[model samples]
Target: MEHIYLLALVGGGLIGLSATLLLYTLGRIAGICGITFSLFMPQITDKKWRITFILGLVSGAFLIHLLTPIAIPAAPTDNIYLLIIAGLLVGFGTQLGNGCTSGHGICGIARKSPRSIIATITFMAIGFITVFVLRHIWGVI
Candidate 1:
């Protein structure tokens, strides 16, 4: 139990530290969806930093797995189609919200943006409603 708390603390600290560093060094927000979407659209001036940031994210995850060997939580379902649908929905939702959870809930909120505050609240409410519908009404989760 204490290990779980320690892990959470460490994980959260890393997130905050990374976000702060990105802001101070690059004058950028550490938004995963925004970072990824930049690869698609034309005329991105600073592509290297975005690519490096993404690589660092992936490498960090791999390094953490190598070091700690934590067990990944099992998915709610094993169906490939279900996973695809969920992924697409998430992508669409992020675009609809103008940012993902990381942008709105973490970086934006930390910077005290009003739009981020409202967006985060809306998403969290919708998430709770969706979970209730899935777990209680439909028994999905």
Candidate 2:
């Protein structure tokens, strides 16, 4: 139980460190959605760094999953169409909000950006409502 807490602490610290480093070195926000969205844009001149950043994210997670005793949680449902719809909804929400949780909740709030703060609040509120609807109201989960 204590090890789980330790793992979470270390993981969170690493995330903060990486976000800080990315901002300091590249003058860019460590927003996963924005990074991924920009990856497909042909006109973006800094594709190399973006590719490297994304690869680092993937490899880092793989390494942690491989090395750690922690078991990654399974998704609630295995329905492919439902999963696809959920993903699309999330992507649309991110676009509408201009950033995802890591951007608005972590980096944006840390930087004290008003828009990010509001967006993060809205994100959390909607997330709570969605979970409630899925689990309690509709019993979907």
Which regions in candidate 1 have their CA more than 4 angstroms from the true location? 72-76
lDDT of 1: 0.89
The whole-model C-alpha lDDT of candidate 2 against the native structure comes to 0.89
Measured by TM-score, how close is model 2 to the native structure? 0.90
1-141 per-residue lDDT for model 2 (tens digits):
697799889988999999999999999999999888887778877888989999999999988879977677786789788799999988888877879988888899999999999999888998899889989999976
List pairs with backbone clashes in candidate 1: none
Clash count of each predicted structure: 0, 0
Q: TM-score of every model?
A: 0.90, 0.90
Per-residue error at 29 for model 1, in Å?
0.3
